[model samples]
Target: MPQIAILQMCSGIDPDANLAVIEDAAKQCAEQGALALFTPEMSLLLDRDRARARAWIESDGPSEMIDRISEIAAKQHLEIAIGSMPVATAGGKWANRSHYFRPDLAPPITYDKIHMFDVALATGEAWRESAAYEPGRAVVTVEDTPVGRLGLSICYDMRFPALYEALGNRRCDCIAVPAAFTVPTGRAHWHTLLRARAIEASAFVIAPAQVGHHADGRETFGHSLVVDPWGEVLLDMGGDASGLAFCEIDLNRIAEVRAQVPALANRRPIPKS
Candidate 1:
């Protein structure tokens, strides 16, 4: 069993400030025997000032936060699951990427977010994420951890069940869902979507999220969750402060649930013209 720590944050415009908080959280979680720590989307900076945020963003290289987290992992002998961070690409667009830093301090495994959130909500707020973020073409899974084979997904990717199905086919035992969900949509579909994915894939679902208001003046619905293979809510960190939530993972539960349910084996293709 691997002990996982999910961290919530209301990140601001400053990457250094955000990293300070994350460093402390990492130490605390490491001290508590957590093998891995998962952080939320935009864990580096959530600046409302897009231009300023871009000024500070780096492309395909190590940021100060990334370096710090890698050092933490090396020193603490911990594995880290970094949520979504905007990585500048050569095409002048950014990619929402999740990074897996192992204890060995070697090159990290990364997954670019496949889905982008571009919505005009009824609440009178609009976001066009595609303008800045490029959607990835590949689905990534990493298997070199103590926990189990891990599938990576960002916020909007959770809305697509086909992605989870693919991960299921890949025999991944756990999935990371790091999000900075809007208040309205998060309230309506957060738990439902997460639970459904867990049941469909029969994998442990770990979600760390942004809470409260950000430097961008946008509010996020927290409630970071750790769900078991049987669709049980093992831990739910409420939507208030930024902190770490802990849970122990049982790979046996994944096999146990799949043995009884057999959803993946029961799949049938739909004929299309």
Candidate 2:
């Protein structure tokens, strides 16, 4: 069993500052024998002003955060999964993406968030993520990792069962859902959605979340979760504060759960309407 760390953060507008937080957290996680460290969404920048954030984003060149992460991963022989960052791309649009970096700092396996959160919530909070980001076209899974094969998804993507189903079909042993979710939705659905995904896929689910109020004037519900293949909540860092939590991951649990449930193998497509 390998221990994994989840860094719950309260990121603000400054990318450098956020990167510092991650670097420090990574060092701590590595020293503590964590195989991998997962961060919440918008780990680099969490600003309400999309234009301001885009101005700070990078298309190419040596990103300070990535560089620091590379050094940390190589030095500690750790695996780091960044929840989301603003990546400049074609047409002058940015993609909200997650990046997976290994001990060798091999070119990161990146996954752009496929589901754009465009909704006005009952909490009077409105987020038009599509306005700032282009939805990703590909579903990504990284095969080489200390933990078994890993499937990648961002915050909002967890709402779509089909995505998890697809990852499960690919036989992913673990799924990462990094998020900066609102209080209302997180309170009501965080645990339920995470546990459901794990149970449905027979895979371990790791979710690191942003917590507390940020400089953007928006608040995020903070309850970083580590769920088992059997839908058991192994660890839940409560919403009270931001910090780190560790969980031991046994890939054999996935096989055990799948053998008993056999849910993934029983799936049948519904008739097209």
Candidate 3:
């Protein structure tokens, strides 16, 4: 059984304050024998004020905060998955990117979020992610990690089954669906989608989420979850607070569940009309 830690955060506008939270979480995860620490979307900064956020966004190179995270990983000898952060793109737009840092201090694996969240809800809340962020072009998976084969996807990307299908095709053992979901949508669809994705891929789904009221005056539905391959909810952190929790992932469960259902193997491609 591999142990992983989930850090549910109510991130604020200041990047430095958020970094302190991450640093403490990394230390706790290391002390508790967690191989990796997974955080929610915009783990470093969650300001809805794009102009204020732009000041902290870096352009795919050496970043002070990122470098500090690398140092933290190196010092703690732990893997850290920063769910998503704002990155400046060469094409004059920004990318909502996820980064994976290893204890060995090698280059981090980066995954840009593919699907943009553009919607208007009944609650009078609207998000137009595509207005500022560019959608990623490729599916990303990292092999030989603590969780075996790890697939990566951001919040809105989880709504698309095709992305999970691609990950299922790759036979990923676990998928990370880090999110900062709105209160209304999270209440209605968060758990359902996560469980469905786990069952569809026949793999474990680990989702670390953002919770509570934020510094940007937006509220999120927390309930950070870890669902098993058979759609069993192993852990639910609830919706009220921000904290760190640990879960033991049994790698053997993957083979057992796949042997029982074989959904990934039985999956047939749908033909276009």
Largest TM-score belongs to which candidate? 3
TM-score of each: 0.96, 0.96, 0.98
Q: Which stretches of candidate 2 lie over 4 Å from their true place?
A: 58-62
Off by over 4 Å in 1: 59-62
lDDT per model vs. reference: 0.87, 0.89, 0.93
Please give the range of 10 consecutive residues that has the lowest summed lDDT in model 1. 58-67
Model 3 Cα lDDT, one tens digit per residue, 1-273 = 899999999999887889899999999998999999999999988978888777668533327778889999999999999998888888999989999999988878999999999999999999999998999999999999999999999998889999999999999999999999999999899999999999999999999999999999999999999999999999999999999999999999999999999888898878999
Please give me the total number of clashing residue pairs in predicted model 3: 0
> What are the runs in model 3 whose C-alpha is more than 4 Å off?
58-62
lDDT of 1 by residue, 100-151 (tens): 9988878778999998899999999888889888899898998967679999
Q: Residue 77, candidate 2: how far off, in angstroms?
A: 1.3
- Which candidate model has the greater lDDT, 1 or 2? 2
Report the candidate with higher TM-score, 2 versus 3: 3
| Candidate 2 lDDT | 0.89
Q: Write the per-residue lDDT of candidate 2 for residues 99-207, one digit (tens) a residue.
A: 9999886778899999999989876888888886899999899896767899999999999998999999999999999999999999899999999999998999999
